[model samples]
Target chain A: MNPISHSPLSIPQQAYSTELQHHLFGRQLLAAEIPFSLDVLETHIEQGYVAKTFGIELDHCIRCGNQDKQLFYTFPCAICRQLCTYCRSCIMMGRVSECTPLYTWTGPAYDFHVPKSVMNWSGTLSEGQQTASDRVKQVILHQEELLVWAVCGAGKTEVLFAGIEAGLLAGKRICIATPRTDVVLELAPRLKKAFPFIEVAALYGGSDDRHKLAPLTVATIHQLFRFKEAFDAMIIDEVDAFPYSMDPSLHYAVQKAKKQTAATIYLTATPSRQMKKQYRSGKLQAVTIPARYHRQPIPVPEMKWCGNWAKQFQQKKIPRPVQAWVNERLQSKTPILLFFPSIAVMETARPLFQNLPAVYAEHPSRKERVQALRDGELQGLLTTTILERGVTIERLEVAVIGAEHEVFTESALVQIAGRVGRSFAYPTGSITFFHYGKSKAMVEAIRHITSMNEEARKRGLLDG
Target chain B: MGFSMANCYICYEKMRKPITWTSLFLRQPKSRICSNCEAKFAWISGETCAICSRELDESFRREQLCLDCLRWENNPEWAGYLTKNVSLFHYNDFLKELIAKYKYRGDYALAEVLAPFMKECLQQLEYDLITVIPLSKDRLQERGFNQAQALLDILQINSTELLTRIHTEKQSKKSRQERINLPQIFRVTSRTAIQGKSVVIVDDIYTTGSTVRHAAKALKLAGAEKIETMTIAR
Candidate 1:
């Protein structure tokens, strides 16, 4: 027997997307949906002249990524590569490189992929993906515009492979714009392996490879300011994400960055009411994926209002059902994640759970805490919404302290709920909400999930 | 009241809309003989330095050069390319007061009145395009708008952001040599677009000519064929 095989893997381990598989096909996928027009591109090129020459000045060292506190020209690290200063840590690691890719990209293509070494990796697909992929392919081939709407967990990333393949095959430049840096880092390696032959550029706040300026660029939306109608196709992911959605400047930037004849695509999970109104009015076009690939119904976690909750916990007593649930998980030894609304409450209740012998952790604690969670060194973690997106932990039971907190919007709650029941082997799980007051948003969120799960079940795509 | 009545020297009200009058006389209750101490100043008129916009004091004063030419700080080979410059009044008390109010007082409506004077100041320095000195981002945001650009719009000239500031500091506080020692601060943008273009650099004043000199340096680097400067006051 394999010594590491004391417990069965809860989910079928997915094969690492090899670098060869990435290159086997030639295209790329974008993170957002953007509009394209030749006129807009020309205008951007004309207007962005001043922005091109504006020199960026930094007050401190770039090597250690320290800012403001460090002085210029002093404590220079020898690995110094760019105009910016480097620090001792970067010098020791040989990481002192200039900040590159400030100017928009030009030339070369490559594939990207997520390496298999990452844990808790389970991606789902839907029939809509093939249709969406085909649409993107057609848009690129004909230089058209497409709008895509996928429900949470609808496997939107995989759909881009086919579109990127077409861009590479045709030798046209492509770019994917997102609002978050974490997403860019997460997506870059995946694309690299998925199409290794094509040179791909991943741009974010401080990525080292930014200077290469590849033909295919993956960047945050703010970086688009440096470009002028530069891409043959521009994809804007999470079209409904905050700050990006609210800022007209970003929308204008995307429009200005695409070629007059370029293809533009938009992707979103929870499009705003205004977008829906426009789509209904035919001012915009859309395609949606409403089901998960697992074909299992999305689980609906019921909320229980535990009034006077602090009083109950102070009596050296935990709620009977909640205690029973934790005890069951302890007996089974399944790692669990307990979410709280604030760090203060987590501190107060942390001791209550210490007697159970399960390691407890929360965010904003320390870098050590996050590492501990990743290493699976802790059995249960109490956290805030900081971990809502871009984090994956395998086979964990999940619970929430206050589902009705105003901070947990419909979109946030949905994304939080998405954390559970992700793997094929462990496609079913329990989610409990301990709320002091019930909110309509909570009801609406649960309803939305049930409807999507019902649709997935109807399509026979649920995993378990 | 004779001194006040002496302000009425150029008093013809029907002088074809009197293009750009000094704000000292125009922005006040019209007792107009040039009210601030009633000092007489030469208004830039006929043929002058085609490049520097230096006024011709006399018809026979050689078509394109001025008294300041002996100390001019640019290449002579490029000297004759620009037209005449019309500086409305010497940088005196009355003009200085109006400029302060117009530039720092958030008085944008004053731009409508000032634009024509700026236009009249350049009556002899014929230019194909006009551009205002570009403000650094920090300064522009603080002031809400560029004053020179606001007035230039009234001249109906298409403008571009051709210069970028390397650093910005108050010029009045710096000495002349310190001003000269200041590095050439403007960098050219869209070099190919400005090739062989003749441009008139417009500003509120012409103190020491440093800002215009820097701006002219950028325009020259960008291949501007001829550069002339025009100001409401020198």
Candidate 2:
């Protein structure tokens, strides 16, 4: 059995009473060198822990040992009696309210299932996707480690189903971890429908399935902190997503969550140079996916320069070429997605599009705002890289305003382009990047897409 | 030549499995208190301003606010009402020692023991969202982590990194007056996201309460209905 680690220490036990130590341990048998005597522990058990730690006085509670004006008396909760001033005013008192519990989300409850018609859906697999699925299938069957290197829109998620189904059939516990909630929410329902019988969980921030640790979990990588060698087979989706890719701690998290006997599979649209090198050197088993699901070549976005767009925007004059392009696209009623380099530029450019009638929005907003982008309620969506992954809309043309800004790195630009031409209905669309100056990243992004298209074409992936 | 020596060291450590500190220390009977840092002082929970952690006498009342928190004087637009505030420690060396391990060290083991202590400190109150004062993007990038985020994560509380610091500067270098009078240094990127939401600001230490107060002011400006603050150390 793997040893489970605990959360960080908040209070020094030596400074605390015997009762506090018992409370920290909880009822569950925790494996640790707890610094306490048996007699002291027994004495604490006789009287409750919270009362000893926080003494109540004359209708007011001694909150962190501060007794000021009288606060409302709330009965002791299972956890503690000392509520913060904010919790004191809560309608439910100090109880854990309906705010989703922080844990993994397994498939819907036992009785819940999506309709059967949606389960057997299939689409054309790109050469990159076919190669990835084959590699993942081999990994799960043989219990071997493998890495799948695909460019964006190479249909990595569909390739995962075969491997996940293999794990489920074999009765082995599996977890697919990513670094973002958007990906987890998107993948959870898809995975659930694909393997309806097997229990699948989606674990991310604000998910309420803590106690429901299923055999399989689709989780954001941050939630990996809670597990210790708990997974038999682990697949990390979007292995190159931000923060996760940048931070070594998250990499440690991936390694830590996998059981010794488990096979780890990494699926990424854009593999880091280090990973690519490792694959070439035979240090990692590798597969490549280089085309969209529709087998159409990824549309290489054309780059245009808008000299001093920010300065021009402040003076309330939209660039003629850019304005003409927007007018043409909007006249066609083609929903557009305009990417900006930074929030500052996005805010500056937002007013320019207001009366123009192109629908615009930002990330981390209400579901309705994001929904507007997909429902085509807005003529266009103004966005940062926050909408780069796990979002797909049909028949949308994308333009990057100020694409040459330092924020749009080679990888980021590649991802932004990947957002174009995702769905089968809109296999190809016009993607133009308006910049003040041409950048190496911009060229690299175009080159990256063209190269992938070249690979897919060489494999005879494209149909006339 | 180095391979054999390294192999021998690895073999030696591997042979000594199940290392036991209890067995080693059993021979020597020792006191419970930390030997290095003597208990020089006890918990001195004296009368303090409920809002700002300022020690005060009987003159302070719920209606009569602290000088920093006086709504009309400090922030005229916002009412600036917090239910209550309190602290167990004075942000001294002892609290700093504990915080270093809790934050930088990835010592989440300490949080399991300490979170309840924070919970105990959160006296009776109603909070809608548990929020932490966000670290500047540059600071977060340099630190490779947010200490406050880690603490709240361990507490298993619902928190949002909503209020982003637009500018990166050494906050500690400025006086309380400079901090209050400081220009609109922070911005609420997610206004409607937090509108009508109740929030409790969590931080490692609260000194003058200016930082949390400013954060609360920003949240309020974004149309947050109510605000409160709690810290590990006062």
Docking class of 1: incorrect
- List the DockQ of the predictions in order: 0.01, 0.02
What is the per-residue lDDT of model 1 for residues A63-137, given as tens digits with 9 covering 90 to 100? 222342311122111212223432222121222223211222122223333332322223543666777778878
> Model 1: residues >4 Å from true position, as ranges?
A1-126, A142-145, A242-249, A308-324, A344-351, A355-371, A460-464, B1-234
Error of 2 at A396 (Å): 0.7
* TM-score of decoy 2: 0.53
Over B175-221, each residue of candidate 2 has an lDDT whose tens digit, in order, gives 97787677666688788778798888787777666677778778887
On a 0 to 100 scale, what is the lDDT of residue A283 in model 2? 96
Quote the positional error of residue A40 for candidate 2 in Å: 16
lDDT of each: 0.60, 0.63
The per-residue C-alpha lDDT of model 2 at residue B189 equals: 70
